[model samples]
Target: MKLHELPDELHDLVHYSLKGGSEDFPEMRQFLGVTVRGDANLIWNKYKKLAKHEDKTAWREWVAQRKDSTAARREADEKRELLETRRRQIEERLLEAGWEAADLKFKPWSDGIQQWHELVEMPKQPRPLTDRVWKNLYAKLKPLLETNREERIEREYIKRKIRRRDWLEGVLYKLKRTEPPPLLKVKPRQSNSETLSSVFRSVTKRDVFPFVHDALKLPLIQQMNEDDIGIEEFREGIKEHQSKVEDFITDWQDKTRVYLVNLIQEEDREYSEILQPPKNMDLDAFARLSDDQKLLLRADSLFYVDTACFRTLMVDQPYDYGTALQTAYPSLPEYQPYDLGTEPVYEPEAPDLTVIHRYATAQEVARDLLEDLGKPNASFVEVNQLHYSCQRCHDKSARDWTSMLEHYINHKQIQAKVDKHASLLAEEGIVYRNVHDRSFSNDRPMIKPARRSSALGARVPVKMCKLCERKPIDLNVTLSIPRLEKHLLEVHNVNDPKPEVHYSLTLASMFGPSPGSDYEIEEPDEDNEEVEADNAPEEVPVEYYWPESSELEDEGEEEWAESDLQ
Candidate 1:
């Protein structure tokens, strides 16, 4: 009988039997729900005839395919059973080793990788984690981690990912050259990395990529390549990574010690170096250090750091750092004015800046001199106690220097007014008043002469915080320049650590308004006086004005703000 002409149940059995060249009449009868209704010899004979007559070669081929498939399944089952046995063996060993239960359990039981599948947790220590730890752990765990079972079979036919980056790098190199290379391992990794890079690029809008190809290039590996590359390309030329890995048994060490160090440590040892204070570095030595070093080392931590800036108004000619043309050479014996034919032995080394100031003091005369000096286009400025002078016009000015630079600020001809007042003081036989006199303030101390041993020598004015009123306005408080400076730095971040000192630079930074300064010198502007008055505490006294006695309308008679005539 033809196969289809038989009953549907018998026909299905025959087809199934033909698929593998095997017959089970009892199972066929059971499938047909006729097991209780006895014999099936007739149907069984029909199945054999269909198999033999229809195609003998096809039947043999099916039988061979079936045997191969059965053998594969049997082998797979044996491998799984063996792996389970091996994993159990490792578990017994590790449990006997007394590792924490929590740690022994690697994955979260569901989502992540299982405990037995991975090596131990790396870095297993407190911070500042270095290559030292990695090397040590790798040595201790090398034998336990590499198992034969895992090596034999591949999940998705790809080897386990951990501890194999370096091996993959080598394998990938070979794979690239090999036509139709093992793609199960290579293609997915490259595609995934490329996809990830595209996502990162899209999100960050950056041109950075995570991978070079199937192999991810780590910074440490790149570094290794840079340092070890020679005339010949050799196997595993990345020696830094190779040396760092403790295991030589497995050719697949990840070579990621340096990468881990960067991730875990606050400061990366390979790529960064922090400056420690030198025991005895000189000012010149510190000055000669590079500007990048200066920024990192903090200029204040070193000696008095400032730049001797050279400026030129010749716009067509760009400035050169090496040019010494505009340097202010000190007056020597050759520059002495002649008393007779010979120079005076006691002639001052440089002309006094007080004499220059006296000349520049007059509004009309100073204006004429400034115009004559060609608008004073360029000045070679030094960064010490910056003193002003009109060299071309007056050649005379005070050598009088003070670190308190607030005296330089003026607007609306205020400097001319101050100059006229000083000139008027001269008429009253009170000459040579110091530029930064501060005795007039009830809070300020008498301007005392400072000797070499004095603690009060060379002090600069610091920005005062308006909100800082925790202490009284006394010497130990805001009046203490250093204390005020510290407060400004720590609390407000309003002071510059290494402010560039220029002669014409405004002292508003020290006194009141500066760029990004929140504090304003409180004054009775009729418009906003009530607003300030409302904010003021009833028990506290308002602040005294920062102006000098000369600037005050009615307080000019005290004469106490004059020079320290010691």
Candidate 2:
């Protein structure tokens, strides 16, 4: 095939061959007509002999070189195989001894075959030493010391223990060998010479006093020496002074009593018998008198009297009972009784006479009086004219009389009834007719027309339904049934049959029955049942079909058979 048309794998192989100097082969270059460059010599050498014919000598030389190359490759392969075998053996030994591959240390052989031999002889892994073995090793390698013997010995022991397992013991031993710090010495305390010198200097001052006598200049001290008195002597002096004051007070009291008695006697002579002094009076009897009597006796002793004598001295011709009682008994000190006078004597206020009176005229008053008497329909103009004409003949009394007469004439019950009737007539827009008798004419109101009733009567019509021939009936009733059925059929397409109607009954009964009643069943006719049976459909059952081999062959050969037959 052409290069472009070759399959992808074949195309790739051809392209590689051409680029790798396949075109440089003499046969290939000569056939393809391509030139080879010098750098293609390696490819040429590799493919040249394979592509070209060769002599026996050349074959022999090639075979010998090939044999030597094969031998060198075989030796390298054997050494690699040996190294792999040794690695596997080491891995196996470590695994059996419960050690990891990393625990084995295999040093590479760097010298010649002798070095390789020595490395092979060397152990692939060292055996782990036990605690006892380590201890023995530490003991053998431990150091011995002499100068500063304890510290040196401890250092040596630590080094050995670090290699063994006595870390705590080694630390303790080191601490034991360590020396303690030297103790500090205490010094003696010094005296305060400066304080002693200051105290001595103060004591030797020239101006300092040896003693003080403050008591020598005091008045209390002079008194104490003159009397040689202590607290008892001071208390005696206070008692003597208090006794002299008591005696002087007693003498002054006696002089005041005597002078009061003499002055009272002189006042008694001036007042006559009404002021005579009482005989044989004691302090208790004086105290028992009223306060007025006591004051009169103390200031004017002539007014004092014995209680029994004073009572007997009042005996004489029968005294005025009121005046004698007033004189003998004390008045109640003439206290004025509290005067809450009648309503505090307030002045009654006068009515306001200046207020303008909104008084009606004589005629107007008459009209108002008539209206008040329920004759509001009376003529005011006629009433006023009567009053004015009557006033021209007489005084205001005549005018008042005329107005009063008019008021009385209009105030009849018959007139009031007539007025009320007129008002009602005006309200209703009714005409009034005069009923005239011999002496009088009265208004007689005509009756008003009656209003229409608003009550909703029955919806029953005065006509009959033309289609159903239902009569003595309402038109609305006829419409309701057909209208309801039409709405059900046209709007909801309900296929229910029309309800039966009885004209003799009310319309309510005709529409009252429910639609779901099975007892009201609509029976089908014989013709309808026959028609339904004629339109009934047939039924068929489903079946599964499988083709036999013969049938399949027959179907397959049918096309051939048809061809042959034609």
Candidate 3:
């Protein structure tokens, strides 16, 4: 007999017998008076599945027959009547509000990601009649509904959207290129300055060449000239091209200024060696000037903006000086006229002052030691990397600049050593030697991961959340420090989020949007407004939004609204 022909009561016994040893199957076969098949477990499994399915089917049929009785059928009929009545009321209200039944239906969760799976399934079970649900439905549908004039306007908008998308894709195509930027690909002999002036005429554009030049630096450029840049490095630089370019430029500018301050501190180098007279000036006249006059000239080079060129344009033609100036350089705060002898002296920039005050005595002492050691151009990078041993303390242990500075302070033999540490003179008792010359290899300073000075304070705008990582969610969102903090507080219920603890210090030197970018958020204007009625009801039945109870439970924690993510 077939497995299905076996009595339902004997099915469990046959299954257990078949599931056991091969010898037990013969007894099962004798009882059923049928051949025991090869692979008894497989036969038993197939039989069990079919039996379970039949049992379920019979149970459903039994339920249906039970419902055919008076009480359950009447209750179901009443619910159906109520649901139909509610549906009619909703349709009437939507029609009164100038919307169709189709317009009031549920839409995809994200319009941008219009996949079939993203399509929202409307509830099969009737929702409870409530004011909140109706209000929410109305609020959601009201903006989508359109009059004839509004529909025409919407037609125009569709064209604009298509055009905008095409334009955006084109821009992205240029940005996504692995080859060097058009600005960086100019001929070798052509001056970067000239290239910057010609191609990057706009204030935003002009900075690009200098930024790329400085960041890649002279050695890399020379290497690239000999044989083009490595594809991997080139790809890295060009990835998220605009953001990387901007970051490079900002960093280069800051480092250049800091280097300039360091240059100013070098006693070994004379002003005459570093500063040159303007191209228009005669060398003999510049040489004849005193040190103070040369200093003044240096200051003028920084602070002086020539208004004479604009004045000539104003005098020669029908040009407004202010308008011309504004057009040429929109970045300038204001324009000031100066006589030939009255050119303004250069005042040090605020950033320069900030750098100067940052380490104070440590900086000055570090500079003196570097100058004395004949490594005046040595940066903090080298200072931290190389090993130093204190000659005064007679300690053979290696230390980096930070520890060396602290050690020097202790030798001051003063109270509040920590507070006044940086104030100590380097000439006092902190003579040091490069530990690379030392005998013990193990005594060399261990390399620590580089950390930015606290003074710099969130230079890179892009940040990643540790909380999100712990939750194992995507950190691809373009959030800055402040936004990351906001996300932590709002989404994770994390109070007083700190950057170092809750987010990474690692710079995103890869393909991603710039910090604070919300390019993913296409419907900015429509979603920005806070409509109280449009929100999901606080205590609405889960069946309305989520079909499954499991889904409803996950909705609170996992389901992020697109606007909130942005």
Candidate 4:
């Protein structure tokens, strides 16, 4: 039981505390002294034996916990106070607004007082007013608003639609630049301690490259050493391989961006003048985000914010908001979306009852067609929610709109089915219901087609390659959807079609009659295996031993001479 005769792990802890310049150790000396006492040892040994513990691991863990708790407790207390303060403030707002208790159900952001996540989590979480919490509040407000002042609710809704129309008009003018219709509203992911209790909670921080980062920090990677292993070439190989990787990544990124621009552009041509990305991306945000650009979207972006807060004292009064809004803005200030250019003039046409949307995906086109077929009540599903298995990839959710579109299109036999469906719906007397319908007919995309750098060349060519676009050579690369998709996933690390990813999509087909037969897509397991194999080579650099440039012409002659000599 002598302290000196204690186990090395225990003795070392004491030794580091007492002998080394680790810290002033009077308490540590006492902490070490008690371990050897017969009376103390009896209880400790019994606890260890009963617990079936063999080593000082338990004691080590206790010391670690003690250290963490000492510092963390105070911080936790301060944070809890702040949270409680915010909670109270929210509660006060709720009381003032006369909200029901059920309307403001909050998921406890912190467990009691102590939070280990603040220290352990890479990106810390913001607790107050998360999107889910806000939505909960909004949901409650919506019911109240509808009940108390239905007219105001409807009026505000109209105003939003009008505002949105103005925004789209701005996009075509290029006076106020435009952004493509968001496929999914994305938000920055928030860090959370995983739990089985299912509750919708808004994320304040999410790791975009969690798997990549974890793999990079593995112990095996940390152990790599050129001098110790006598493999100096290993380090060189890593550096060389990384260089090739960076180059490949750059090329893939450029290709992905161009592909997106092209896709969205096609959408404008097919439907109406739609939003396109700014030709010159202000790289300030891109540089700041780096790989995390995908995860940097706002938390509230999950759902489109259809309602704007009109926080006038007039709104607080028990009066119709619609009347109040109209009264406040009287003439509405002669609103126009663009100030830089005069609005273009074009002759209007009669409303086409055949609900044709120039959407960038098969799902959208299908949805529009379905709506035209008197199925307008179909709810919009979020990108994160759609989980249908893809038969072409032979894998579940390669996680891109293109992959989703490929699966959707393949089943329907693209081009042929589109016309057939339209005709089918038309025969059934299904009137079109456009999502972008507004108060005035002027809300529709302009009659004048949007101007683009490639004016006449903006058409989708036949037999397109989705993966690689060879402008003049392979103009119609996207027509081969399966081939292009396979190549994109295998070569580029691009998987999901996120808002952050500068990519676009458009459906193309020679619409006429339903063909005699469906387009037979060959599903070969071998092709998938080959593509997967090719993807493996991306991790390593390709090394080619090249002969001198001067010797290039004589190399074939030299080989022949050597063969003759042999």
Candidate 5:
């Protein structure tokens, strides 16, 4: 009979019988014309008894125990192989280092083993390797060791030192001496006459200048004869002779003053050198004040301005007779002037009144008032009135005009509506309000339609959200991933599979019961009621079950029989 035609009980028996002795079943073997060893029916009966009536639990326990034992044995074998490999590698390295097999001895301890060369004896007074020997060894061994090996060697040398304490102290001392000193704390000071004189003497000693001749040149002095001349001629002759004499005296005096001032300025170097101040004088101070102070002091003493003949229109006039005398002769230092108080008098500048007048102009007045109202553009009445005033009159002209205009505009209610819309937009992050200016309100508007451009030829429709039915004002939400994941799972009842959890779910599914179904919404917890509302799902019936041991055994028997046949 065909397998399917047999009764269920008989079929199960035949299946198990064939399965148990599949390799050695005589009936199956004869049917297939292959070699067979045992009865298939008998083998199947044994397995059937084991599955149903036999002590199955104990047999399972025995099988598990055998598997564990086999795994443990294999693991031990693998570990032994690894240890053997590592031992071989270590031995090879030692052998390469010139340790012969006979010379090497290993002593095993409780923790581990130590290897030593029996042929090599400890030296009592071991001498350090000569430079030549050390260099040769290093040249050969450096390629074999890592960069950190040099540091290890040095540390070993230090540790093996005969007088370690003294050696360390000497090294520290040498290091300290080699270090550079901290920067000097002193600031520069000004040079004086003594310093300048010393510098001059040094320069002279270097033979900087040599003059061939040392004679003075003189011009003849003449008196005009006015007695025999006409009235005009005589007057002209006197004037001409007086001018010549005055010019000569002025030129000579100016030259002499300049020479003396230079000499005094030169003496500053000598004075500075002799004093030996803590710091050098700044070059800027020397250039600006040094020559000026020296000249002033000299002129004060002689009661005259130096280089009086060279004076231009811009020069200040002599303050007193002392200044005038000093200008004529700089060398006479004994003639000192009366002291004036050192307090500086600063002349205040006159204020520009034009600024006030300019502000009163119609354009300026309007602009200023507009600015105060927080508006820059004069054409925009809303902004201008908030910030600025009337261009013509400040108080009288604009007060009524602005009030009437503002009243009319407010009556229109456009500003109020705009403000309300702007506030709404701000909540959505579409616009931001200016906190500083109360009148201007929010800078950005809610809906900014795309502008048509001829260059582009066509305009595209603006993108917007479907649920909120408004374009996302600011699409960027700053919630963290974990919080978002929790929101999706708790609010929507969707199970999102983590990399670690082998299940599939989407963010949208997690947020709700079914995809696009408003039927099964999850309610928010009592604690999260203040947060966004998560609607509850409609109620539905669900069933669960538990099977009896008899039913489980019968099912297991059937499965076992089928498996045996296969």
Candidate 6:
């Protein structure tokens, strides 16, 4: 082919060869079908020179871009290596300064410094003046240390805030792309007159504004231009609307609670806490207690009603209840508001285990799992290797906790049962089992590993795209499960990939060399005198023994027989 007409890969290969990619010009000539004898070397050299000039002239701009790309990659690698080296140096310095890893894990910096100073001075038995000097130095350094600590914390807080804001914006963008949650509505009271008017009115997004506002607390920025209101006046407008939203939510909650109270009273199912005061408490105290406090004492019933009411107010859709709950009470640390102070202690919200008259929805299943995990906001990654299977479905297939929630929601039969409130009639059984447990059927499908933050030292599991296996591509490109899904979407034009159908897990090797292989203790060769001598018993070295106490009288019974042992 003509040099200009050559395929891009071949042209690039020739260019690479000219750029010192290969040493053998004769081999290049043979590869390019320029094989002959005699003047082939001179011809090849001339061809290479001409090719170099042509390639450079023709693709000068592209060559520069390639050079820039290569430079960027080189710079990134160097930067990463530098960062790694710096981390190692810091660790070494910490060790040398007698600081434990835990000392620096959570710190004000002064604590570690103090601990290190103590470690250094404790064995010295220093003079009083020297001790005072060290103390003075610490006193002078303390303010600077505290200042540095505050600055560090502030930087981290700002970083966290930026990350959370970006994440929220991304989520909001995604939410905009998907279908909006079902609007919550309530039927109005019927009229006594003959006019049969419809009571149903679709609730606007404004009705669920309070919970969303409380949950996300997204920033409100004014539009650039307005006829009457300036940017400064927007805050006042928002405050007025906010007050109205809060009042609406409070009124709705009060009416809902009254309905719940009446229902519980009719059923005679209210706990003692809800019914009467304790024997130790006076009637005045009982009367003074708020209804919420009283209900909180019997939290199970309250939680059940709370969850149901939240769902009713938020989405009014069975499948979307869990998503609404997640938005309202985000469990992930990143999703949480950045706290400048020490982490606020949270009382674990126990699951409402009191079986309702309905089959569990995705919301309830997720809540139960969260309560069990003792981190109501945690993701499926926390419960590593565990998968949930529905006994009611009678399918051996398992799913990760998040996917399990989705399964329950999407199951038509389960949704029907849930709608009819007849799940309690059946067992409503779901069990979580470890995927790695051999006792379970080997033929059972694997659950996708949860995606985790790319923290240093995190061991991400590998997954191979099953789609790639069927395609004309390299089969060895194993990625993390999340990355595999992304790869399928980007490269294979596949969306909504199933873990079992679209991907296969590549678990890390657990089996090492057998016990009797390289690690086995070998039998000694007694036949060789040299081997016998090598295996002969030896006395404990004198250096290894503790020094004799100065108080003990020195005995001359032991003779010095030191020789060159080194």
Per-candidate alpha-carbon RMSD to the true structure: 34.5, 63.9, 27.1, 35.2, 42.8, 32.3
In angstroms, how far off is 18's CA in candidate 2? 28
Question: Candidate 1: misplaced stretches above 4 Å?
Answer: 1-55, 105-566
Global local distance difference test of model 4: 0.30
Top-TM-score candidate index: 3
Each model's lDDT? 0.28, 0.28, 0.35, 0.30, 0.28, 0.36
Runs of candidate 2 with Cα error greater than 4 angstroms are 1-44, 50-56, 99-103, 106-566
Q: What is the TM-score of each candidate against the true structure?
A: 0.16, 0.14, 0.24, 0.18, 0.14, 0.20
Model 2, poorest ten-residue lDDT window?
203-212
Task: Encode model 6's per-residue lDDT on 285-404: one tens digit a residue.
Answer: 346545643442221221122454455442223222223333334333332222434465231232322322122343454544444434343322223123444433222234445445
Give the least accurate 10-residue stretch of model 5, judged by summed lDDT. Answer: 203-212
Question: Candidate 1 has what TM-score?
Answer: 0.16
Q: What is the lDDT of residue 355 in candidate 3?
A: 19
Q: Please tell me which model should have the higher lDDT, number 3 or number 4.
A: 3
For candidate 5, what is the TM-score? 0.14
For candidate 1, give the lDDT of residue 17: 18
User: What would you estimate as the lDDT of candidate 6?
Assistant: 0.36
* True-vs-predicted CA distance for residue 270, candidate 3, Å: 6.0
Per-residue lDDT for 486-512 in model 3, tens only? Answer: 556644456676665666654434565
TM-score of 2: 0.14
lDDT score for residue 441 of model 5: 30
